[model samples]
Target chain A: MKIRTSEYIITEVFHSLKRNSWMAFASVGTVAVSLFVFGMFLIIVMNMNRMAVSLESQVEISVYLEDRLTDSEIKAIDKKINEMNGVNSVTFTDKIKALDIFKERLGDQKFLLDAIEGENPLPNSFTVKVVNPSLVKTTAIAINDFEGVETVKYGQDVVEHLFDITRLIRLFGIVLMILLAGATLFIISNTIRLTVFARRTEVAIMKYVGATDWFIRWPFMLEGIVLGAMGGTVAFIALRIAYNMIVAKIYDTIAFFPLIPTYPFMTYISIIIVCCGIVIGAVGSVISLKRFLKA
Target chain B: MIEMKDISKVYENGVVALDHINVSIDKGEFVFIVGASGAGKSTFIRLLFREVLPSSGALIVNGQDVVNMEHGDVPYLRRGLGVIFQDFRLLPDKTVFENVAFAMQVIEAPRRRIQHSVNSVLDIVGLREKYSCFPSQLSGGEQQRVAIARAIVNSPALVIADEPTGNLDPDTSWEIMDIFKKINGGGTTIVMATHDKEIVDIMKKRVIAIEDGHIVRDEAQGAYGYEN
Candidate 1:
């Protein structure tokens, strides 16, 4: 209720914080470590998923068409499949050209060459590259039902497993974040509680002397926020260092994989870290002050 | 002015602290609540500030019906009163000036006004030279005086001193009582709780004696009279 009067609470809180800088810093440090691990896990999991999708893109599905189909009908079906969505590119392989490729591959084997010469079983197929490998199964089902299409073939099992793994990773990431956040709040609140306990006498006197609840609660809450933010900053720096180290190792060994953009990832991670710090700190202060501020 | 009508406080275990207390005091009247330990002196003081709600009855301070007052209004009741404890209760981290300024700060006084008022209160308590000293650094007597200064810094209408000199020696007790008398003379009503028979006899103020949760005696000019 007393705006100017609450300044006294702020002044007193800061004075107490200054007196116990080591303790305050230690508490904040604990929060930072917890949040850092959480953020690091999220970033790594996301990158791993991206890497999986990138690897799955290398497999392509090819559907063979009946030789009786006209050139116009073949072009129409290709256009229709492309227009149906998720189809990236469709290239036509002529039956004669496919036979020539097969002959060249089996030219050293006399029996394979003789069998291919006698049967001429190889047919013209459309090599279809989809936008997402995970959609290949549905695309194959649609292609199999289409007129004049012989069969749809791709690494379906590998794609299915990759999708399953990505889903599990996402689910685990969410659960892990919730648990980490809860732990962060617990540790920070306990830390702030110790500080609150030290000044329980001061809080009691202030309350008895007519200090409003919020007036008594604000400075401690702010103290928690400051501690959280400080810890978050430390965590941010550690994460960036860790990110760079890990990214460099991955680039050195697995040069084929796509790495996350450093600048954007850092920016997002920083915001997340700061927000986590503030929330944890605020929650901690509220938890710590609940009992002591009772009327 | 303050009024109390049959205010009673009974603990859950049936140890009655105050029993059907009816009393009233006009503006600027200095009074004392004197009794032995467990005689409800502290309970009576706490009642006026709304620190402990009476079990039953109507209590009014500054025209506000404290019995039916909401929790939000308790601070308003306390604003018009200044309560001091035996323990100084000064923030250990704050300087003497800051400690005294806290009363004004709680009521949201302007910064310039706060500085001026704190300086004046510290001067009244004779601690202007030790404005920056922490409570631990001050003497017991000086600390009590600072506590007194903090209590009256906001110019409250009524001052409650609960054994203000409980921890001081005889000389220091007299010094502290002198400060209270001076404060009362300045038109702030005082209801001090003390069992110091010598101080009570010398001061000759209106004394109300509480014996086992009952007001046994009320005198216009009374002394410490419970006799244990």
Candidate 2:
């Protein structure tokens, strides 16, 4: 690793790349496309998980009070629910606030609520969120037996189906990511193998001239690193631009849809992808060199 | 600088390349190994450089055990010797100077030493003016000379050439031989495998002839006794 050797290796790598410009282009292109696809799926899986988490966190039990409970009795019920295991927070909404929320949700059709304006039938209810989404059903059932509580409803069937869907999404995302990663490695390595195969005679000559395995391998490994870094940069840029466009489009159309913000999330994804590209590049070169380096 | 005791090579396909060969070469001797095609001459040269292992025998080349040497040590063994091939295996992309300098660079020679040694070796091979020319720009003999320059750039104790003149015309082959003669005169042991009878008879160096996996003759100042 002397300065002279490093200089030689860098020169050799650049020389080989220049000599086999087409092969180098093809290798870098393959790596970029493969990593781009991987990055796209990764972004999708991450955002899906984020959305799933947001949805799950919104699941809460609605505890309606008995028709005419005193304010003190309602406060007692709130305290009791707050002390319950797994209860994250309990917020009581009076009948007037319930009516206001219903009207807001009605949006441009708030005129429908005009027919019942004088008689607010909404009951006082506490929205109870649990520490864990999976505890929603049990927590709701436990809250139903509280004194002075009318009934607890957490949209049991809808919550159950949402959990099932999110679980499926997470499992599918994991399996798909693993499969895509393996495929990317296989393809990138094979592309690198072809480049190495083209220079195999050079390797043989170096070997005969008493070049150590590392001495001969250093240039190729460096070539791989360069190609990988270049490809990773291309993919990172493409992913960033594409994600931003998609985020803008989604925000424009479905403004309420939950998407992970583009700041640290994309930054993290870029780091992971570039690192993957580099590692795959280095590993691919080593694997390709294995057969040729044998004496 | 080489000792082979009861050497034998059996390829995996059950072809016997060499059989029970015993030979010892001193340090500074120019020996030519002559044989017909597939007559085990190549295997003999290959064994000297530890390119292929002996099936069962002991081979000591430049004081290193060729047969039992660790794989990691093969490069060290090869470093002490120079090897040339008939096809003039120069990197097509490298200039003549870089090609020769590559040998020194492989062993991590200092930059100044590499520059100095490469220039001197190029001078020896008479390729000083053609240092910037690629292999494709050179004629067959000139390319071989560049190859020679590269092989000897490190000043190895021994030089091995397999058909160094096989692809050149007679005149060009002789020109390549003159460089080998000059190198050998400088006290480097050279083991060459060739089929050129005229050059062999004229040089009158030690010759070993192999046929069908066995050495049939070993003579000092011997001629290539085979018909073309």
Q: What lDDT would candidate 1 get against the real structure?
A: 0.85
Please write out the lDDT profile of model 2 over residues B1-228, one tens digit for every residue: 999999999999999999999999999999999999999999999999988999999999999988888899999999999999999999888899989988888899998998899999989989899999999999999999999999898899999999999999999999899999999999999999999999999999999999999999999999999899
Model 1: docking quality category: acceptable
Instruction: Give the top-scoring candidate (TM-score).
Output: 2
Global lDDT scores for all candidate models: 0.85, 0.92
Candidate of highest DockQ: 2
Off by over 4 Å in 2: A62-77, A80-87, A93-125, A131-164
Position B141, candidate 1: lDDT:
95
Clashes of 2: 0
What TM-score applies to chain A of candidate 1? 0.86
- Which residues of candidate 1, in runs, are more than 4 Å off? A1-14, A48-62, A93-117, A120-123, A127-147, A150-165, A257-261, B10-15
